[model samples]
Target: MLPVKPFRQRTGYCGPASLKMVLDYFGIRKTEKELAVLSGATKKQGVQDGEGLVKAARSLGLKAALKDKATLADIRKYIKQEIPVIVNWFSVNEGHYSVVVDIDKENLYIKDPEWGYTRAMRLDTFMEVWFSIRGNVPSSKEDFNIRRLIAVEPHKPRRGRAKKK
Candidate 1:
């Protein structure tokens, strides 16, 4: 008999799984000393971008779910082996980092409202972004973190510099 689990039908998102482990895994307010330990070697390096953890996870095998259409079982199984997460450091107005969460109806749930990239998204629209990021889904690097619709005001810069500077 197959094992029955809660949230069995929903396609659990891998984004949060890996991210949760990444940020929350280590000690809070990590000192430069502590951060150095994570980076390896014994050198006091200034805040390196948070890309390292996400990069390492991909090497281990974590992928994104397309169209917000992934199975909770599949995600759970994946997480059991290794957590999947996304690393986003794009924030001009808000925090650069955010963890992707679940999807319901058509909106992609996310942690940290500051990013303001994906206030909300349609399932179909998000899928396209997801697929676009990785080219294809369910890959050997099956787990992936996606950066989608990050609102960068390309026009705003020009707005302030009007009338010929």
Candidate 2:
């Protein structure tokens, strides 16, 4: 595991979907409880960067640097930043881009640009079965957000069972 060093450290929140801003944060993916579970650190890494895909891509990297300006922008364009597991572009079609991000039992901060707001996805419900577990995205690209795309999946019932119709 890459030593628990944050990719960047900024002064405050940057607002909206900007990778550069997100990277400056420390705890973007793991919530306090989750961090306690994962790193056993007294402090947590929750609510760091852009969440989901960004976090996953970052952690999986052999080097694990916060997505740089170009990289972040590139990713925002193609991959859904909701789950860190979405390490790259091709996985966009697998419908398996699920990963925990800024989770807090009731809230799950995602980063798909389209997935405006949703929370607590019950990650245990879908662990490593995600799409980009192997982590295979080349370093980000220029004019990344220019493409404007979306990642879709069969909606899993938010509460428990989909109400039996």
Candidate 3:
């Protein structure tokens, strides 16, 4: 199970919060404030794009990649490998991000930072909401198109050297 961290109320911090969870899964400890700075998030605007997520993860020596128009199969493959994927989507007509931690035959398990817990949604409904955020036009609010995915690849820890005799 992925560690879930809820974004502070009234804070536009879903990106950093989601990133924190993924980092935590990899045993990387970082506070939300540190993650916010690493992700280039601001109070005036949340994570502007997936670039912030990719850069932040890479800064920590992790291989992070952003995939556009990602499919359900793609997410499942990552989860099967124990790599958590952050999905960008629109909820209530507003841009939102969540971590895809697990999946079943009919449902996708999401660790929603905004909601402060794990929520289950049918795969079809999840895809619809995920794909709905699309377009090139920019507005005051966050606008995104073609489902975006930030995959945090697993990194095997290197063993430390033993003391010399």
> lDDT, candidate 1, residue 67?
23
- Runs off by more than 4 Å, candidate 1: 1-22, 25-51, 54-97, 112-118, 131-165
Better candidate by TM-score, 2 or 3? 3
User: Arrange candidates by lDDT, highest first: which order?
Assistant: 3, 1, 2
Question: Candidate 2 lDDT, tens digit per residue, 1-165?
Answer: 101112221211111222221221223333323322222222222222223433332342322333322333333332233323122211233222222234443333343322323224433432222222122232555312221212211123122112232
Model 3: runs farther than 4 Å from truth? 1-10, 132-143, 157-165
Task: Indicate which candidate wins on TM-score.
Answer: 3
lDDT of each: 0.31, 0.27, 0.75
- Cα lDDT for residue 19, model 2? 29
- How does each model score on TM-score? 0.31, 0.24, 0.82
Off by over 4 Å in 2: 1-92, 95-101, 105-108, 133-165
lDDT of 1 at 23: 32
How many angstroms is residue 116 displaced in model 2 relative to the true structure, after the best TM-score fit?
2.7
Error of 3 at 40 (Å): 1.0
How would you encode candidate 1's per-residue C-alpha lDDT over 24-116 as one tens digit per residue? 322112232332333231222211233433343333343323222343343334334332223342233221333443445556444442332
Better of 2 and 3 by lDDT: 3
- Residue 102 in model 2: lDDT: 43
lDDT for 98 (candidate 3): 85
Residue pairs with backbone atoms closer than 3 Å in model 3 (clashes): 134-145
